[model samples]
Target: METQKINVAAILVVALTGIIVTVLAASLLMAYQRVPNYGYVKSVGVGVYWDQACTENVTSIDWGILEPGSNRTQVIWIKNTGNTQVVLNMTTGNWTTPEAENYISLTWNREGQILNANQSISATLTLSVSTTITETDIVEFSFDMIITGTEQES
Candidate 1:
């Protein structure tokens, strides 16, 4: 009879220990669930309206003799027609076809000094065209200009 009673006591102790462990585990899970959640927003902003304008003009090219090895200095006139100041970027190209519309190839782009608002700038466009260019050889040019708020376009 005493042995049976001790066995019952041992079983009760084990059951009580298991219940306590289960309760502790449940409590820890509840605590973990109470943590706050943090997330990031994926929306971004973009430019809506940019209203700056610029223009460039090529004034003159000093002509040279038609030979195999001749270089000439071309004078260009640049103007900023926009209300704001502008920075002019110049690109050199070769004429490939008629109508002066088609360009065969392009060279590295170059930038001129800054100009102020409503201002005009001039630079010498120096190029070493082969003397094969006669008195009426057409040179292709493309103009690109950028305007900054802090810069002047004159």
Candidate 2:
């Protein structure tokens, strides 16, 4: 009877071990994978900087590496260099891959906000990569971000 009990114990252990391994494998298969992307920052009628002092000009934004279905945020300082109240607008262009527009999206925290002359505001830009982007063709991608400031007529 002791041998029979030992056999049952061994079977239970094996079953639990198999279950744990299966769960771990599944989690890994469903995990997020890294995808790299980048873009340039261009400002018109204003100054886009990395520092509050506006000493450092923001040239390019490197998202390092992005994970599918995830979002990466970059904070930038926009200082109104003009003498009048200006409204801020943002647009993207020069997409290396047209499909990138479908998989990637850019959004900012400041929308339709008027910036006063000599005033600075910190804005957060979010880059989102769609989970459904399984295309291996997009090994590298690039785009341009154009931030425009229009004078708000008094």
Candidate 3:
């Protein structure tokens, strides 16, 4: 009777070991299942572009032989040669001749505007000389025009 009991205990241990090994093998196989990756992810690139001419600091307006009581209108062409729309802002530096400030007046048609891709806009600058200006007064003015562009949100 003792031999029969020992044999039954050994059989139970072997069965339990086999069950644990089979469960482990099944789990590993499932964890490493081979699946085809039919989908792929690609990255898109984005950038900002600006016109070459607009980026330069070259003079766009030149009024030669400015006379007293004369009004001159010069157009500065702002072009957007980029792939995205942009908001443009213009900044003017202080006049070179402070004495001429009162006698000379400056005005712009549009100081701020929106420019679309591959589009151009004109900014008319009107310079007026007051009648009080004398011939020998020699009113000389120089300033900078800075054009800044910011990309528009979609």
Question: In model 3, which runs have C-alpha deviations exceeding 4 angstroms?
Answer: 1-60, 134-138
In terms of lDDT, which candidate is stronger, 2 or 3?
Answer: 2
Candidate 1 wrong stretches, greater than 4 Å:
1-65, 97-110, 130-154
lDDT agreement with native, every candidate: 0.45, 0.87, 0.68
Alpha carbon deviation, residue 86, candidate 2 (Å): 0.5
Decide which is better by TM-score, 2 or 3.
2
Per-residue alpha-carbon lDDT of candidate 2 for residues 75-104, written as tens digits (9 for 90 to 100): 999999877788999988999998888888
TM-score of 3: 0.49
RMSD of each: 12.7, 24.4, 9.8
Give the per-residue lDDT digits (tens) of candidate 1, residues 42-104: 321111122222233223232444343444554444454445544555453343434232322
Question: Which pairs clash (backbone N, Cα, C closer than 3 Å) in model 2?
Answer: none
Ordered from best to worst TM-score, the candidate numbers read 2, 3, 1
- Residue 1 of model 1 has an lDDT of 100
**Can you write out model 3's per-residue Cα lDDT over 31-100, one digit (the tens) per residue?**
4557777864432212222333455434446777788899998766667656677777665567787677
Best by lDDT: 2
> Cα lDDT for residue 128, model 1?
49
Worst 10 residues of 1 by lDDT: 43-52
